[model samples]
Target: MAKTIQCTVVTPERKALDQTVDFVVLPLYDGEIGIAPDHAPLIGRLGYGEMRLRRGAEVSRFYVDGGFVQVVGNHITVLTAQAVPADDIDREAAQQQLDAARGQPASTDEQRQIRDRTVAQARGRLRVARQAHP
Candidate 1:
């Protein structure tokens, strides 16, 4: 049998997931990172992308926005601003959001930042949805 580690994903609104999995892949601020049982203890800032968890032959996926991740003692905790399961994502709606974000005019730096973040999130959602469907 494959080894497993506890993984918990939380958002401001609610707890997204809590389970034991054979492996986990997170979207770090710099890039993607994979974790498994006995992984080195560490902390990292998360980026907007898909977070995938695997257990045996089953794979679970979530679109995660900005957050932080911590790993210690065979446990991984993810605290994100937002998270949506791949099955729950609406590709058309996500595409609309991406288009809106792209078309919106950013008058200020803050507005630009927000717009960029929104675009990234919508893109992530679309990517995850496509992967789920295909």
Candidate 2:
């Protein structure tokens, strides 16, 4: 049997997941990271991308918005603004959101920041949806 670790994912609205898994892979601000049993203690800033959890031969994927992650004593805790099942993401809707964000007026610095964040989020959702469907 494969060894596992406890993992919890939380958003402001609710707890997204609480399970034991064989392994995990999540996007960091700079890149992706894989966690296994006995992972070192650390904290990281998460990026907008996929969070994959593996249990035996089964793998589940989710689209996670920017947040933070912590690993300590064979447990992982994820605190994110948003988390959605990859299969639930709508490619068409994500694309439309990206387009809308692109068309948004970014004349001001604050507007530009919002537009950029929206664009990134929409793109991340679209990417996950495409991967799930493909």
Candidate 3:
């Protein structure tokens, strides 16, 4: 049998997931990172993108909003603003969000930052929505 790590994903409302996984791939603020059993403990800033967990031949994917992750021994806990099943996202809605974000007036620094964040979130949603499992 493969070694597994306990993974838990949490949002403000509730615990979204709790499972044992052989491997996990998470989107960090700067890039993507994969975690295996016994990985060195650390913390990372999460990004708004796909989060994948695999156990044997099964893979589960979710879209995670930006937050933080904590790794300790054989456990990984994700504290995200939102953790949504990838298959639940709507492609058309995501696309519309992206378009609206792009068209938003970014005349001030604050406005530009908001627009950029929205754009990134929309893009992430669209990407996940497009590749959702059937």
Candidate 4:
């Protein structure tokens, strides 16, 4: 059997997952990174995208808007500003949010920031959906 690493995914609201996983694919700001047990110690800034975790023959998917990943020894932890399981996301609601953000006027700095984040989250949600079905 392949060596496994302790993986944890967390957001401010809750701890999403904690398990021994064979491998993980994360969307860093630069690109996608594949990690496994005993991987070289590293840390990365994540972008809006999908995170894939594999354990044996099972795979789990999550959507992350943005965050950071830390790797040390046999442990990999992902801390994200926003995240949700792909299966738990509501596609229709996501689409509505995307549309609403797009329709809003570029009036204030705060509003623009929110709009940008909403778009990023929508894209991440879309990526997770595509990856989950593929």
Please report the candidate that would top TM-score against the real structure. Answer: 3
What's the lDDT for all of these models?
0.90, 0.93, 0.94, 0.85
lDDT of 3 by residue, 1-134 (tens): 66899999999999999999999999999999999998999899998899999999998989999999999999999999999999899888989999999999999999999999999999888888887933
Off by over 4 Å in 4: 107-111
Q: How big is the positional error of residue 19 in model 2, measured in Å on the Cα after superposition?
A: 0.8
- State the lDDT of candidate 4 residue by residue for 15-132, as single tens digits: 9789999999999988899998899999899988888889889998889878999999999999998777888777777677778768877689988997887787777787677666
Decoy 1 TM-score against native = 0.94
86, model 2: CA deviation in Å? Answer: 0.8
Residue 6 error for model 2, in Å? 0.8
Assess candidate 3 and give its TM-score to the true structure.
0.96
Q: Per-residue lDDT for 15-40 in model 2, tens only?
A: 99999999999999899999999998
What is the descending TM-score order?
3, 2, 1, 4
The number of residue pairs in model 4 that clash at the backbone is 0
lDDT comparing candidate 4 with the true structure:
0.85
What order do you get sorting by lDDT, best first? 3, 2, 1, 4
The CA root-mean-square deviation of candidate 2, after full C-alpha superposition on the true structure, stands at 1.0
Q: TM-score, each model?
A: 0.94, 0.95, 0.96, 0.85
User: Which tens-of-lDDT digit does each residue in 1-134 have in candidate 1?
Assistant: 66689999999998889999999999998899999899999999998889999998899999998799999988999999888898988888888988998987789999999888888887888888888777
Using lDDT as the measure, which candidate wins?
3
Better of 1 and 2 by TM-score: 2
Scored against the true structure, residue 132 in model 2 reaches a CA lDDT of 92
lDDT of 1 at 122: 79
Clashing pairs in 3: none
